[model samples]
Target: MADFDIELDASGLNCPLPVLKARKELNGMKTGQKLRLIATDTGADKDIAAFAKMTSNPLLDFYIDGEKRYFLIEKGAN
Candidate 1:
């Protein structure tokens, strides 16, 4: 598991919801801080990665536990 500064549970949300909330959280976080996002939407695997890249935030790590998807995102200067 990766060390994270904050955690966001976007479980049950679909599509852009997870990404949108993550973006909102990341925007308030300082650079280099990591966010642990817990989501149930299967689309989050790709969506979160794309969102991270698009925002310049690094997707540090990702893993799965049953139906749940986990993403570790580190805030970027942008």
Candidate 2:
């Protein structure tokens, strides 16, 4: 179990909620910090990836476990 600087559980949330929460969580993190987002929404795969690309954040990892989608995003330079 790797410890992330920010852990956001967006399971059961709808589209935008996961992305929104991820953004907010990342906003409070310092540069180089990591955010782990756990989401159950299927759309999160694309949504989160696009969010990271659009925001210029590094998408460290993206994978699926059972019904959950996990995203590891590293905070980008300010």
TM-score, cand. 1: 0.96
Tens digits of per-residue lDDT, candidate 1, 8-54, equal 99999999899999989998999999999999999999999999888
The collision pairs in model 2 are none
Give one digit per residue, the lDDT tens place, for model 2 in 1-78: 355788899999998899999889888889999999999999989999999999988898988999998899999997
lDDT of every model, 2 decimals: 0.94, 0.91
